[model samples]
Target: MFEYQNNNYENRNQMYDYYQMPETGGPACNRPSGPKKTGKAGKLVKKIGAITLSAALFGSVAAGSFQAVNTLIGPTETSDNTAATENTSASLLKAAAIPGAASEKGSLDVSDIAETVMPSIVSITNKSVQEIQNYFSMFGYGGQTIPQETESRGSGIIIGKNDTELLIVTNNHVIENADTLSAGFIDNQVYEANVKGTDPANDLAVIAVPLESISADTMSQIAVASIGDSDSLKVGEQVVAIGNALGYGQSVTTGIVSATNRTMGSNTQVVNTSADGSALPTYIQTDAAINPGNSGGALVNMKGEVIGINSAKMASTEVEGMGYAIPMSRVSDIIETLMNETTRTKVSADQKSSIGISGLTVNESVNSIYGIPSGVYVASVTPGSGADKAGIKKGYVITGFDGKTITQIQELTELLQYYPAGETVEITVKIPATGGTYTEKTLSVTLGAAENSNNTQTESGQQEDKNNSIY
Candidate 1:
């Protein structure tokens, strides 16, 4: 089974191929009904016409599927009528194209699509440091941790660029905890990349590579992907997936839209409601093979327009060809926001800011048990600190920091690593309302210097320090 951050991905059954043809003739304002004939011969002629139209429409979809199969395997000879049938099918396919969506509603050549779209796709490499505790510490020896560097691979789509950076979009998990990020472009050259911004709740992130780092040759070789309307997507429509599958560089896989508007958790499991406080995200389910390294890849239509971002795949011994993607139409605005966020670097420990609050993580379980808001439950706010000065009370739950949503004290702590001392940020809190209810309030707080960073307390009243502390 393919595993991405140990999450289980899911997908459901597909839908029908073609749409029902309209019986009415032309526009309603100038509509005209065809002359009716009562004779049995006339009825027989109408039946034959209906069958011919259905055959042509069905033949269009069948031809596309056959081409997909042929693209997978070697080609085989077809009957002489195939040419004429395909010509008729093409006309019907065009007539059936969804009105609002720009469609390539005809025979598809997988190789042509791959050649056109691969330049906009890139392979991502994330290098991060993980701490591993010594096993000897369990046997009475002093506990010590070792820093280990790890590398992982994923894929990304080149969306756009700014004055100094080339912006690429990918799944947040692909670059999570990344100490150093790199993008390998179509030119076979790798360049350093920085996280522009991240929406962890949606599992989306935009990374930027400096224009100066990329060679002109590479710049000429790569292209920005053409974005398509996911809202216009129809079930069973053929789509192509391009990604750095298994970290073997970009590869192409073909499939059909199995389903849409499938609500899912950030972990990729099918869920009606998010277990976390964040909003539940929806995905486009397809039969495409989205592998481990395929996370953050492109799911494009036959026109080579990106309609979805390939994120996860359902891998099971009992099921096959089920994958999920974040629909492009749903997150277009989010991507813009991420792209506009100021690129930041982790502040040094000495220069970092502290919110000066002792808080405990309150998740869905805590909310259900205590009837409190799901966020960082502030047990104490230090006097004269930024949080306290901003009118943050002891019982208030910190729900958001700057623009990022916070469900746990650890999230707040992690975010504090980027904002330096004296930088003012907006913090959203849930204040205690009448009858144990909570009302969200946004407060502007100037972060304080980390002078007492080592003297934080956990929920159990245990003394903790930064880097090793839970809060």
Candidate 2:
């Protein structure tokens, strides 16, 4: 059984409920009545006089103290006590050590960056409501059904701009099956967006909105961020992140480029799990503080160019600050394909013949338990699959597939995708012999489609199933 822990689910549900409620002031504002006077005139007069005298004395003392303080320090040079003295000393030391510290020599003005890039950082609000049906028996004979809703918020960056249309790039999971989507700009203008295309395998999506819907001034000032080469980034290079932090607004956070060319997953299974579960990339690691809403935002270089798209964070209960991004180099390819409408091209027939298999390498612990070598092991075979009909044993250990030596699941998938379908291929397997050692045998089999399982069956001279199980 698979376990799920989605913190955003509850928050989104709460947000939907709050949006449905009407504003009202009930128990929040209430006051008590003032005390009533019920005393003789003479006694009340005396009490009033005493209170007035006390107030006058306090006011005179407060005025005199203020005058004394102001007299000691003139208006031009106001009194700055011990705290200010310590601050002045610290500033003097800092100024003496660094010649250009006080001057804005190397720093770029924030106002300039905001004025240029803020229009490109779009606020994305994706609303997806799963209708939860609740049936309750009313009295005895009838039942009532209740429908609940949930919604979520995320951010995206404007990566494409034509003369008439603007494209916003965001995570596929952000807009996946969304019922409604809205894009907001820095000018406080919101526009309903349309999903242009999505590549769930890559965890990326390109959304579009009409240019006329947004503010004319904002559209004119919008700058399509210049894409930078993520390959050229180093471990210690400076980087900046501009994103909608926690849905508050566009925020800027700075850090150094922690690492690059980092591989997070190895095979197709690994890629599928990571991309499908968390919507993460295969490479590009950074140290930036990438929060929830920062997904699909821009990971910019010091030159104000976007180098990557902020994707995920790797933090535990005990650690923090490890984040990852999809390199802009890969993003560029996806965007270009979407813009050209070439993403729908099908894989070649030759590439589809070689079905990828993974999770074969037995670890030390598994070796001790299974009494097998620490190599790729064929755990199971798809029924009527290419390998199945080829007389390849299910429990038989696979030493290699094609010509490449496989160690992980991802390696197998990548290699298989390179080949086409309906091609005869050879597979090497290790069979348990009379002795403790295994004997290697080569078998030739006609490949079948990856999606069709009924085409594969036990070949002649292969061991048949002991039971009458169709699988």
Candidate 3:
């Protein structure tokens, strides 16, 4: 729960429904039955004439008064001119004294930034399946689970391109659990995209589109955005946000940096903190109107350089004009790592691999209550399975997989979608040691087929359930 302006508000980052078709049925336009009478027009013309005559009479009186005053004052042109010059000079000095006051850069023209950055921003569409629970079960009938296809829209920035693929960086939640993805470029052309890699801790991901799939015209039109140093950003510095707002086409919004190094504590979207303990996964707080579809868009500086990536915004009935973006400098290295990762396509359900284990997520509460390390606590291991053969025992906590950090079962499950069965990978686990401490050990495990990934039982002869089980 997020609060704003002394009022309770939630930090909302949900996606807007994209690709909704327009409805054709509506009321038809009705034209006037007949032309209006000339009576009103004639009266309006007569009123204008009378007003003009009155204006001429007032002007004559004002001129006569001016002439009388001039004769009485006896020619004071030099004094009036001198006073005007002094006043103008004083105003100029005052303006110069203040920072960013009435100067060339003070009043920015965002049109130029929009023009340069629009080509780098793209509209992303995610097609995924969501489970819908049945309402009829309340009447004693068995509930049926239904899978519904959903389409969501987000924005991405073109970071760079290799010989084979064009890489775009976006928020991880935008493409999470996506069955298919497509990017709409500035040239109005859409291309298929696949996730290259993701860092869920930072809520960032890099997606790649094949260069050969894009048309030459679109390739010529799209460009990589210039990256700017977010560390150099100052409060009240003017910035522009460009994105596909509300699932519409590319649009631009301008605002100043309300504050820097904003840490929205306990917000689910931002969970990590700096290694030096200086700040939490900090955000660039701005007053720009970042709508639902603006997630993963670019927060650009006046020089048409990208300084931050639009991620989340605070929403409330009593609040307005507060949005947040992830600073670019903080995640530059992570983005580069994701870009260089091997691009993988989602494996089919039948071919997906699984490590034979049922585990519980060791979240903050569990870690605190049990005095155990934060990771997945293995409840049971299937007999003769890959995990069992690899010396994985019950009561051990799995911490890392193939050099990637894992803290929950869902993260492991999502990662298994790319690695098929029989693929050998390293699995790191924390073994319970003396003094109630844990020792880290890495083991090579060959993944088994999904059919044999069910947990059997623990050594204590207790029946193990498949709650929160993952492959």
Candidate 4:
């Protein structure tokens, strides 16, 4: 068994990856299948042959055993598909740091910019079949997770289009864990979408919808939004925000850049750290009216170029005029990384095995005061997960996986890299009885699929329609 070790550091700032978790709580309603509003680029063209990108597709499974869906496939090296929009985004990000480099500065005609970019914007609707556990299932009673339907609204921007598919970018939360995804265009038309790649921790994802979904004329009408240089932005600069406000039709909000390089404390976010070791995310703070369903929308400059992605806002009785957007400079690499994705080796939710517990990373104070080890402190468990089947429950502290010592969530994730679905392994957990004493136990757990491991967390995150505001 791996043992917990004690080490100390001072003033280490924990930078949670910055992502505004969009709220989903509200009355469920059918998303309007509006008429397809054609854009300059989405107009019909010659029908191209289909392109099939398949990952680790699981074959037939035997009785009583589950396999994880395909794991993500990516290139060992970068693809050479350099389009103009991609180059423009790179140039814009550079302009911020180069003294003489800047997009034509000055106030721009908001109307002209809005019209040019609006065609790239789209409304996203997610349809899901969730399993709801009845009362008996709640307390270890005979509760089975039943299928329930839920729908949510958000927005996306058309970034690039290939011969066969139109690639769009949006927040991962909008399409995450959904059974079906659809994109509604300005013209009263909606088409099925498939996930090309997603980075949930970064709150970024790319989805592909077939070109055949729209007529050649409609395809010609759609335009690809030009990514602008966020680094070139000055505080107090004018910007425009557009989104499917309140699940209604597209609405526009105008404001100035409020601040730059801002940070906020929130629930655990999965983000990358800078080489210098900062945990904070960069943002272009603005006063734009970024409301619900705007999480993945655009924040553009006067030139009508996208410089940032509208993400979060300060919501409180006491706070106002504060909203945050991920700077385009910081996101260029992330978006490119996602676009390069080609396959998924992991299984989907239903077929995978998992330890079944959700947890929080314990900090030093808790460890020093309560003697609780610094590791993943279990908060809950999925009823049907491998950890649950092994009798694991909430409040158990997982200290080790296999033979590796783990003291943090990152370590556990790294250790998990070695194990896969349908595989059995030994895990060390600390369980305490009612009297406040602890016992260490080793359990033989057959690991569930990875996709299944994320289901409970996704379901819990989507449970309430409350907290459904921007970020």
How many residue pairs clash in each candidate at the backbone level? 0, 13, 0, 56
Query: Which has the greatest TM-score?
Result: 3
Error in Å for residue 310 of model 4: 1.0
* TM-score on alpha carbons, each prediction: 0.72, 0.47, 0.73, 0.54
**Cα-based lDDT for every prediction:** 0.78, 0.61, 0.79, 0.66
Model 3 pairs whose backbones collide = none
Compared with the true structure, the alpha-carbon lDDT of candidate 3 equals: 0.79
Candidate 3 to truth, TM = 0.73
lDDT for each residue of candidate 2 in 67-108, tens digit (9 for 90 to 100): 676555554343434555566455434322222232222323
Ten consecutive residues with minimal summed lDDT in candidate 1?
A: 1-10
Q: Which stretches of candidate 1 lie over 4 Å from their true place?
A: 1-107, 138-142, 265-278, 456-471
**Model 1 per-residue lDDT at 60:** 67
Candidate 4 on 206-283: residue-level lDDT in tens? 888878777876677777888887888888787889877778867788888888887654442322211111144667
Q: How close is each model in CA RMSD to the real structure?
A: 16.9, 22.6, 21.7, 32.8
Better of 2 and 3 by TM-score: 3
Q: Give the runs in model 3 whose Cα sits over 4 Å from its true position.
A: 1-108, 138-140, 267-279, 455-463
Best by lDDT: 3
